[model samples]
Target: MATLIGREIHLASRPTGWPTPDNFSLVEAPVPAVGPGQVLVRNRFLSVDPYMRGRMNDVKSYVPPFRVGEAMEGGAVGEVVDPGDSALSRGDLVLHQSGWREYAVLDAERTSALPPVPGLSPSVYLGALGMPGLTAYVGLLDIAGMQPGDQVFVSSAAGAVGSLAGQIARLRGASRVIGSAGTAAKVAYVRDLGFDAAFDYHDGPVSQALAQAAPDGIDVYFDNVGGDHLAAAISRLRRNGRAALCGAIAGYNAETPVPGPANLALVITKRLTLRGFIITDHRDRMPDFIKEMSGWLREGNVRFNETYVDGIEHAVDAFLGVFQGTNTGKMIVRLD
Candidate 1:
């Protein structure tokens, strides 16, 4: 056997505002040897998400910031090349948090074996069957306390989490599902995903868009892009409405603080429940999420889209594309 040289994207510098290509560097290094209780994996798919932008900043948050000169981490699915002495076997597919790299050496316990889903690619574990999927499920079902026949609205509905959030609300018996996207094509895509209404936020004020989409007021709001969207949802939430404050991509790259919803007083007037959540804190719900989502996928009750950018070298571009709305669904990098 010969040595394996792998490439990984390192955070070269902290961005002051929106990150540029200069903020990342692709470096080649020897794949580390698997030691006891560890496994060597060759990553096949890497995820690029909006939340990762926040990790590039030097800030204290739910997750630690990505360190300069170090490989950034996110969700990845790979095949185990060496299982060392662990229960996992060579050639087994696994999911771990060692992304932004072509290969990873991980603790056996830290990596979860990915069972084969008939007719689905392992990359699905990186998207709909993975963290984003779980985030949508937990936020909408648990945090928001969504109920049947609820009129639900999801922002950034064309992105990975929001797309699934809107669909999950529909599948869970919401009477009406509305969404907002950044582009006309995305709005059409959201409508195709079963949203009763979807509008391009670029068309006009977000508040006006939400008004036309849900005239009677929304019973639940799954907020992925905050800022203006938050204010819009706050203004339209009915009494007792609940909001699952997921990611605020709108403020991820802000150099200074982004303003909060101006209509925040509506939270008081309507007695709405607005809660922010970190998906890591809801792992206990994964079992239920996987069980239900897997069934949905198998039965074709749920649909997902992924935009693949080939090669480890383009991973940073894929990451940046999320904020630019270059992807209609999950942005993924396919490593060779």
Candidate 2:
């Protein structure tokens, strides 16, 4: 087979605050050779997630910062084009962490072979059926210890993890699921996805909105947006309420440091259990998640939405779109 020229989006410069299109650059290079125990794959879809924004900053965090002038990486689903190992055959569908590119040559061990799900889009593996799904599952089930009959609230409820987290709570028998989003459309979308009450956070003070949405008080809070949302959840949490802290997108691009929720003191008064989690640290739940989430998708108990923009060249726009709230659910770049 002829060697392929691959294009990838690279971090041109680290942003001091909010990112712009100038922070990224597209470069062309030859696809690397398939080494021993390695495979060459052509990516079909690339995921643009909110967490990746943190990777762009030069900070000490859970994941290393993206190196300037180097290719940015995230989740991707692709087809193996050249097999150098028996584990992954040619044309096999695989999920890996080499996104922002059109082709990748990596160790076979680094890729997970995915089985096709009937009537489901393969790209869902990057969203609801993949990391985001697992993040929601572990955060709500393990971290928060959500129980049936709980009154649940989720922030950023129209985005990838938040969207699924709210639905998962309802599926697990939460008495009420309330969600907050940036726009009326997103608020409506989350309600359509089974949130018992959904409101536009921009409509008014988060605390007032949340209280109006869940007058009985929230038993569990799935936090995807920090800042005021966290404060709101804290004020409304029932005694001994549990909160699963996930992404803090509200402050991800803040130029100046943002203050913690002013109502943080309520945590002590309400006897709340607030825990933050990195989804990568909880791999033990993948099996259970796959089984349950797959069944949910198949039975139509769970649903996922993805916004697709074609071509690797549009990757930066897709990534920026996450921060802009341009996507209702997962934001993906489909390579042609």
Candidate 3:
């Protein structure tokens, strides 16, 4: 049997507050040969995300947290190095749940072989054209019932999910689309992506900013960073306004939890509806999301940005950058 070699990182320890470089440990291993019904992948890219912070805690969650010393789990884009099943062949561009590694042996049924598009990068399967894209689509269309002419506001507007949410809102003919970002640069970035009004949440009170930007009130809130952002959005939502609680990054790294009254009383006063969902929670919507995103991408209407780190050794810093808003788009690590 042919022996293969690879580099890997495992969950060395869980973070108490913000994750540090020490929380992960790089390790090396000989890659296993592909077994029957499996395919070995040589990973090209891996994803680092804020949600992973939550997963590091051993507490109960929608998904289980990683165990200490275990390989940290996440999405990856790669190529098939050796095929052991008829479903996938060697040299296939693939996406898999391969984690923080340079190579992996996965069952053929567990990974997807990507269809080739001349200019599109395979990494898009991990970002705007992938889970983030699908999350925005499902949250807006199916969850929030974003009708044409509805005004939509998205938080964390320059990140992977928020960037696309703004563009989609515009494409849906929202009367006014607003977005909030952590810094002036990110605000400007979102505006460049076609937000009707964009604001740096750092500038002033978000509620006041919403008043100045919208004058009226927002109809839908695609919330990414929660805590004060959600509280502010609640104060400015119109009667019967809807909210898709997509993420709560504002509280992700806190040593103390950010309490969320978010004026729950307003639910009765405004007759509002709030829904929280994970992307994988709606797998049934994948076909529609892929069709729509592909069409917009082909039409050049929806654009995407990426911030890539060159290697897995810097993966910790890449992952930590999300909290400091160091990344302008999806933060990814090239593992080659």
The models' CA-based lDDT, in order, is 0.92, 0.92, 0.87
TM per candidate? 0.97, 0.98, 0.97
Q: Stretches of candidate 2 above 4 Å error?
A: none
Model 1 residue 12 CA deviation (Å) reads 0.6
List where candidate 3 sits over 4 angstroms from the true fold.
Answer: none
The TM-score measured for candidate 2 stands at 0.98
Model 2 is weakest, by summed lDDT over 10 consecutive residues, at 105-114
Residue 175 in model 1: lDDT: 97
Per-residue lDDT tens digits for candidate 3, residues 109-191, read 76777986546778888997788899899888888999999999999899999999989989988999999898888988999
lDDT of 2 by residue, 176-241 (tens): 999999999998899899899999988899999999999999999999988999988999999999
User: lDDT: which is higher, 1 or 3?
Assistant: 1
Q: Which stretches of candidate 1 lie over 4 Å from their true place?
A: none
